[model samples]
Target: MMAAFKVINQYWLISITLICSKILPISSETFHTRLSPSYFSQKLGKIGTKLIINGIDSHYRSFFARVQHLTTPGFCGAAILDSRFLITSANCVHSVKPQDIHIEIGDFSLQDVQMTIYDVQDIFIAPGFNLNNTPINDLAMIKTEEPIPDAHQISIGICDEEDYDMINYQKSVFGCCGMGSTNKDPFIKLIPQVLKEMHFRGTPMDESNPERFLPCREDNICTRPMIDGGSICNLDHGGPLYKFRCGSFEPECLYGVASYSKRKADRHFQTCNTGSFFTNLMYFHEWIALTFLQNSF
Candidate 1:
């Protein structure tokens, strides 16, 4: 029965993969018109200032062959330790060379002047990561050659283990950030947008994949938006879902990269829905310490 189930799942995945290959066109004007001003207002409410990475244009040009460029591509990532390191989803680094990935900071318009481009020297993928499950180990670390200056904008937060444990499955909120999409249309030029918060139910993992380092409970929350390859800002898998410390929204670290949804259709159907999974970073804290921070102290 297990074998049969595996075969059925593979068949379904293949069918979906084939359908996602086709490109659908959308006009820019129509795309922008579809988005309500309220949506932008809502997004801005969560994150006041936008962060842009500089040197992305030249990097994109140099490494376009690699890296999966999403239709509406810019994704949000937090600066780790004063811009020397960045914590983001593994999907962001998947299949791309170190030279290709560029870090952008500040607003979009002045990206060229404000952003800092760093060449990735090493990429560390969490162990036991499965492409199918995309479980917790869906995290990666990008090591830059040189340290970035004026990295005051880059900050890391402490993980709230207490909040994560007390989280109510039904009422919990999952916040995510990225370049917001204009519309569900597939052909629109991808614009760089900022973060947005959405409410979701917590769905934990049934069984832990310790080897791959994934831990999720049925009650863990996930975003149901159409975008894929984005990170859960304050959660595990590098970006931790954070709640504002002073208010009800203090950023707290929760789940990590585990799994994501693939495009199964086009603009007309469920094609807009792209789900990404992350691993719980807390589970692999030891690993990160041994690997990245071992020699720091």
Candidate 2:
């Protein structure tokens, strides 16, 4: 069953998830032939109709990080925000101790794990956040045991009103990666088969759609794949939802962190074409900056 979590101003528990999909084998014909749409679908894979196909090292861009719970043997997706701080869902790390949390950056492949794991020194949750409530102020700033490398420039998510309206009106698609489990059973023993990339778009909640749910609440952003082949509800708990900047000259920008899915029909299982909800980064902008300012000083 999917975990039940609701953030109505107060903060609480839940996670965004990514599942391993079955991809067919590709060969020389795929590269040489002028293939059909179905061929490309098979090559790209129908599981997640996304920009970056899963498991391609070149496809990975900057600022992506993963949150691992050392005590629980589970992981959440996360992102680097600066040299000393990273961001993730507050609900994700809610009850965990600071020392038990580990953050991994500069790693594209979630498996064959690369780079040294950065241990967390302190975890900053939204000031108004309450562990007893739903995940409203659903963000967390993690201070690393040491500063990130000087060469790394973390992706800054869109928080200003101008960029927020631009992406929504433009119907921009965002990408996320997960090392989380699939909703299906027998998933317990499975390590993520490949680094999973899930696709979603920011959209208005249309309760009229009949196939989805409430879509989002006041502090949430609705994200869904354009087609029925994939689901955001199944991706990793703490993954970042990010988009490219307006031009080729610009870098990738993170905008949301996976929180919880607004389930349709109040059922634990997700239906086909269901939309998921994210902890809207802009909604927590003031808190984010304030947290950073207060701590940095």
Quote the lDDT for 151 in model 2: 26
Clashes of each: 58, 12
Please give, for residues 1-297, the per-residue lDDT of candidate 1 as tens digits. 334335332322222222222323435553344233443334333222322111011111110011222334444343354445555567566666766566555443223434445655666666654444333355666666776565543354435455455333223444433333323334552344332333222445322222343444322334432112232221212333333222123334434432343343332442233443434556666666665674232
Instruction: Give me candidate 2's TM-score against the actual structure.
Output: 0.71
TM-score, candidate number 1: 0.54
Model 1 segments more than 4 A misplaced: 1-83, 108-113, 133-136, 150-153, 166-172, 180-182, 185-189, 192-201, 205-240, 246-259, 262-268, 272-276, 295-297
Task: At residue 132, give the lDDT of candidate 1.
Answer: 44
Report the CA-based lDDT of candidate 1 relative to the real structure.
Answer: 0.39
lDDT of 2 by residue, 1-297 (tens): 122123211100101111111223435464234233444344335443221222211235467787878888677778887777888888778788899978876656534556558888899877666543235767788888788886255556554665567335235556666655544322333345445566555666734247544545667677655334344433365677776443211235777887754344554343323455567788888878887798773
Cα lDDT computed for each candidate against the true fold: 0.39, 0.58
Q: With candidate 1 superimposed using the best TM-score fit, by how many Å does residue 116's alpha carbon deviate from the native?
A: 2.3
Worst 10 residues of 1 by lDDT: 55-64
